[model samples]
Target: MPSNRKYPSLELDVSADHRPRIRLLLREGIIAVQLLVIASWLAVHLVLDERIATLGAWGPLLMMVALFTIQTRTNSDNVWRYSGLLFMLTVVLGFKLIFLEYPLLHRQFSLAMTVLAVVGASLLIRGPMDYLLVAVLSWVLVMPHIGHDDVSDYRWYLAIFFAFSISLGWINSRTYLRALSITLQIEQHYRTLSETDYLTSLYNRRALMDRFERFIESHGGGFFMMIDIDDFKRINDQLGHAAGDQVLRVLAARLRNMAGSHCAGRLGGEEFGVIIDTLSPAIALAIAERLLEAVRNSREAPARFTFSAGLVPFSHDQALADILIHADRCLYKAKRAGKDRVHFGVGEHLS
Candidate 1:
């Protein structure tokens, strides 16, 4: 039989400090305001003083406090932290319903007891309308239960307060969530821009270097190919720089179309470097040939332009700089070995 392995716990993963601060502040705000309407709570609790000892009565109380504590402990989504207000309302209402302590805290704990059910329903419901309906129904059912201290009146005041409070809370949470989502999306876009070339929308030189460093550290296998467009300056000399820019853009697009998504852009006058994620020397050479063919075939000028490439797949004992130097040396050899060709660590011409 194989022996089971036990992993030892080492470090605790914690969220950023601001996350906890936000949870704590929101929970404090909700608890502060909700506890203020003490008139009805005191009225109900007076009727059943000894019921506090029962699990039914104390369970909801303990759960509500515990929920608030958990909400403030971690703000990050990965931490299973509660959305403070919703959790507080949930545990409070759920415990009340399960314990049927409605007669005790009337509206404070009992009036909005359906909100507890709404929070609970949120867990079960798949869409917005389902939870919204639960909330509406809970509010509706609690309508008859809400009234003034006097029976002579229809208890319209309590109804007005309940409706106003739920409406305000719902709208506030909706607006807050919308703003939060938009902010997150904008932040993500900004992060992408930081790592990519603005003109080409390709991974910039910095990002490419970072990836190369990681690959080297991991002993990753691949081919790093250097490509240079033949007679790029001659195009600019004959036509204007605008034409040169157009050709460069066109070249970038063609390269992208050839390589698909696994390509990066370094700031080059007429050169581009690609670290192809291929383990096969033959496959890397095939791609180099394909790129050479595609670029030469793309745009025809008065002197028909073509590209020269140098591919380095592996050097088991070579340093990183040595690999680049040799690849570059081979690139110049291809250029000298007559312009339009591909070289893989030798003078052997690519057909």
Candidate 2:
């Protein structure tokens, strides 16, 4: 049985389309860090200081409530991310304000330093530049408490702590960059697999339909052409499937070259299609004739093979399915009028 368990790396996947997941991870880490900081402070306070008169003892709990409220109430990822960053700053500034009134809490600057480092690492997504900004904030958080009597020992501890924090922040940022690269590569690979025909390297049928829908919504008129190889079954039956595949590939290349910036795709099997925008009926017919000629002249095939094409000039209001059906009918007429010809509509044929 295949394992249903997705690895932890799956959580780190960050692409342009997956930014919400990245924001969610950061928000969750923020919540966890806030809760842990609050709980630890309360536990230590209960054990050491029975007096409730300490500098803003109730402040962290209030912030916790606020963070929880923000998390629950807001659906915007940008709000969550920036609010979490602001919360960290508010928490640090709150401690700063309290320590001014109560010098006894000056020692807690070490704790504030740790908090800034942790939150910065957990929430910053912009890599080392972000880490540099957080390092500056770390200095600002710890500077006011530096001249206290016990700060000599605290200074030594802080020096080591700052180094650790910078290293950890760097690692976290690097991890984000690596994860982003991997996500983009994965996204590109999947997009290619979904949109491209495997054998012919042309846009697949599904991608073609999607582009056609976009064209319809744009309200711009264009020419739509349907192409079918003249005798693909005979080629496969007599020569081989390989020879048939070569013919398809060569034909697809010719169509791609002819279509230029326009749309071209494999509809399925030996049938292909193209849409040319902002072109007149005569130019569209000329392109159709050129495509037919390219297939006929292809030297990569085991034998010369020709294609029948149906061309239909459509207006913005024309239904896509109806236009396609009409073009297909024209293609059918070209095949019946004799193979290797282009048909604009009924009674309009060119060899």
Candidate 3:
């Protein structure tokens, strides 16, 4: 006796960013095929045959219309479920072709089968279970006359069509998956290049600003700081630019460790920027002093390098240019008074 245990259906895992795009393409393609079938059937029956729509054809057309409508909905979790049901219904309608008196009507159902198979194969990213579903759907397209001795020709034609369709569907699914994978890799590569600094592997100035805008929008208020390495040019002059770069990298790593959930970026030329979560000058100063201590203690930097920072709190209504200007003034003050210290300017002073 055969075992009763059933294996679970396989699901294709896609990146969150790509899933919606693939689903949209699949929806559009499937809808276009459905509309094409409906239009072609109308032309054939109305123009050539001079007959009205039959109940047999109407059932599947209505089903396809309903499925298309459902697929058009936003944020559907189980689009595949609805689409699979629609294809199954199409296969059932394929069986009706065999009982028709006219052999020409058989070709109509075959067109529908070919369209569905091609659409499913090209647009859907799937695994073994999805392939199994397509295979079953293809088999059903040829299932109508398995026992019919009279219509051997129809069975043979459909069998060949089924074989061709299944093969094409498999090829199409593989091609789609490969293309999607390549596209995602290219996107990721470009995204990383755009957002990351070349030397320190931290976020670049532009990326940080973009993130700052979003952070300000969401959190309403935060603290921004500008960090400048003291005597940075001397390091380049004494030890060379390579050692300077190494210093920047080490400083970046230390800043990242201390930044916590806050954003940090290389703001060009031995200067970095950080956005701290708190708006309080006292708390923010404490955090900055701790960072200063960490960098002072770390042996990764050559010749006991130190940095000066200027911090200012920013509210939602404050313009970014004004905030940076105030922060820059405070930074200049710190550098002028003495290097290697944290300075704070009141946020309301500039605004």
Candidate 4:
């Protein structure tokens, strides 16, 4: 049985792209650190003449900053990524001094690094806790590889290898995780954009209607009001689209705030719809009046336009279509009575 019985929301994010990028970065960093440490170890004896290893060891650190900048962190997790980078740095330095072709090491040094790499790969998927788990797992993986002539013969070198492996694994895993996190966020944002209205930051008509049906089913019955602004076209004509945009935004805010737990949405253009879970006609009227006031306050016109709402109650007996028809007629009566009131119809409401 899986520990995670509940699944996470399938929100695709930049983290997917990030996982690959982080992995690549860690790989490059570890490889570079490996080369530099090797060169530094050789230089100590008769290995190399130049002190180039000093520059190389720090080169990966610089790349880390650049990679992170491109990764664009959303929070504190961004700053912590470098901690893992430093761990990889340790691994490389340790590998060069103890496990390499020469030097003084305990026999277990090289064995430790191999374990570090494998466990680090696993921890890379786990995110931040890279240090402890990756380090311990590396040691467990290393013990089996020790040989008589190995660096284990120099017990001190073996300890260096252990510490070094842990550092390298931590650093490598950090970059990998940062990238994964980013990709995940990106995927999620994309999915939201598909179902959401970008302008008002609300659910679009599609989402609203879908949920409206669910609300009706859940509560056994309810009311559905199809609301439209009486003269929204005039606003667009007189104030320009931008100002019209502000009006729609203000109107949407008012509706959402007033609707509370009821489902509300911009059906499209300057129109909105609402679904409320209640059976009493009095409860319905109160909701309708509040909704009207919300729209009224949002407008600045002395001769401000108002919406005409058509409310249809769903009884256990009526089909959704019949309820919509009755509500539409009541809405027509409200509009015919001068366009700023809520009207209800158990049957068709005559103007």
Candidate 5:
């Protein structure tokens, strides 16, 4: 049976290609934030004398160490990342409430810390569920203290600040996602252009070979059919290049229809390749003959044309160069025997 599997598109390939870079950026951002936190801790120690015993002084440092360990030791697993962020948030809020004596300083520090937490959460967390959870938790932790002391005067102000910070973080996160989506799309477009033949809209030589290499590696064995248009240059000489181009395009469409787009590619001008995922050479040859007849009978072409194909079965152990050489030799034999025929590497001939 013919395998229903198809080649992956450039979009998917581009996403996979960009994943490591995205992870690296996230890792770097986390490390930078860790350094900033250490700097803040030093600055706080210089200015403030009142401390909540040793726990207040050391709690944040311990949390930072834990977070650093998580970030460095793991592959940025979301569970660990979110757990670290939540742990840091709890420690920051708990320490700020306890250490700062002045109600106003408490209020200011609490709001600033919560805002920073939200912004950080936005960067680390992709979905709003985790982000919203962080925001809501910060609000809950900070709300009871809003009415406790002289800070009561600015209760409304603090509420507004919380709302504003959450909104800002959400917007920032959405913008980041939108920009990332656009970047991936653009990269996929360029990648597709690079991999595709401009004329036939089929995989170009390099891309085709890449696909062939991957197929052989995965499937272990298959058949390769190399096709060349008979007297293709004569079309350009007699009817002009435009007509020749039209004929080529029509033939490409026929080949794609017969062999499946993922299985077919244009190797270069007037030549194409198809990978057959069948075990039997007889089935592979049948497919090649069908393609020949399809191109011959195609009504869309500006001029009628036929193709010669060299079909060779390959095993996973066989190098692509060797397979190509054998197929090309068979193709040369078919051309010598006379054009518009199929030649098999196993000494079979069909016209």
Candidate 6:
């Protein structure tokens, strides 16, 4: 059947609108890494010289706590989450610069870890604007230190690493967006296959019932119809099963066209169901008559054939099973009286 399924629009930039679980995992991973860095720094200082480790370490630790708290409570789209990460990074770099006095190698190792954290955070933020903001801010934070005698000799290496980190983060983000788009397409394809009938290209029984239930819940009432081809077995026996299939397919197309926006589906064998969202019984009956006329005049069928239909007005207060049973009874009556006519349940008075 033709699908009315809506899909997400694919864009060039990566955002939190796709694959939320993956974004959550990446956020958690960044937080965990920051916590590891803080713990390791505290442990090393405690071993070498407990005096230097003092209350200064608390600044970075507290910043990490605030970052984690923001991540847990807010979504990626929140400005507070991005601001918190930048604030935490500033606190960490500032703390290292002012409070800690370590060797050149140790300082380089710490800066490299900070760069990694920035790259991870970049993945969680939206688009190029946020990414550029992060890249510039990180570079500015480390710029003053580039001239310092402690690590001035390795400035070129630091610059290269920064460039590489930015490139890597952008590439990863684009790759993630592409993968998410493909995943969504595959999911939509499979869902369409599951809901559609193979032969007649109409919604299957399960899909039709689900649509009927949803319509009842939303619109409060509609007309439910059960239609069956007259003497379908005779057509199959005389004209062969291939001709029977063609008749079914042609009739389904006519029904779908006549029903317009209403839900129409194959209910197995020669029986089909339609749900029309309308308050007027006359309008529903007119549509049913048109379908019967269309099937009767169709040249695609092996020979002239007619169908019987039963239509019932459904309300929110009525059970779906009861409505189907009532419609089926009306259909049975139509077949018994004579085929090629419309039968309607009680409450609909026609002249």
> For residues 239-317, what per-residue lDDT tens digits would candidate 2 score against the true structure?
9999999989888778768853278889998999888775577777777887777777778778899998888877778
Enumerate residue pairs that collide in model 2.
Answer: none
TM-score of 3: 0.75
Q: After superposition, how far is residue 347 of candidate 1 from its true place, in Å?
A: 13
Local lDDT at 45 for model 3: 52
Best by TM-score: 3
Model 1 spans with C-alpha error above 4 angstroms: 1-54, 57-92, 107-109, 112-144, 148-163, 215-219, 259-261, 300-304, 314-323, 346-351
By TM-score: ranked, best first: 3, 5, 2, 6, 1, 4
**Candidate 2 C-alpha error for residue 32, in Å:** 10
What tens digits encode model 4's per-residue C-alpha lDDT throughout 135-231? 5654653353455464456667556666676666666656555555655555545655655666665668787767766666667677778777787
TM-scores, all candidates, are: 0.64, 0.66, 0.75, 0.56, 0.73, 0.66
Error of 4 at 170 (Å): 3.6
| Candidate 6 per-residue lDDT over residues 80-194, each given as its tens digit | 4575456446544754554245545344455665566557645555455666666657656654233346655577876777788778877775676567556656665677778
> For model 1, how does the per-residue alpha-carbon lDDT over 1-351 read when each residue is reduced to its tens digit?
001112222222122533343344455554453343222333344566766457655565555556545544555644333333344344444444543445544544555554444443333222244446555655654443444554556466655655665555455555544444444444445656676665555567677667665665565567777777777888889987777766666666666766522465654677767777777777888888887787777763334567787887643443667656767777887899998897787433223
Of candidates 6 and 2, the better by lDDT: 6
Residue-level lDDT tens digits of model 3 in 118-225: 455444335445675756655555443333455666667666766676777777777776676556555655776778888887889898888888888888798999
lDDT (C-alpha) at residue 346 in model 2: 36
Q: Give candidate 4's whole-model lDDT.
A: 0.59
| lDDT per residue (tens digit) for residues 1-351 in model 5 | 121223333232325455555556567766676667666775776666656245766777677677666765575456555655665575557545553556666655666666776777677655566778777787667552444456556767767878888898899867775666557656556778788888888888998999999998898688898999999999999999999999888977786777532478889889988888888877887888888778778888778888888889888887899888888988988999998998888744323
Candidate 4 TM-score, true structure as reference: 0.56
Supply the TM-score for candidate 2. Answer: 0.66
- lDDT of each structure? 0.56, 0.69, 0.70, 0.59, 0.73, 0.71
Q: How well does candidate 1 score on lDDT at residue 165?
A: 53
Tell me how far candidate 2 lies from the true structure as C-alpha RMSD in angstroms: 7.6
The candidate 4 region of ten consecutive residues with least summed lDDT is: 1-10
The segments of candidate 4 whose C-alpha lies over 4 angstroms from its true place after superposition are 1-127, 137-156, 167-177, 217-219, 279-281, 299-303, 315-326, 346-351
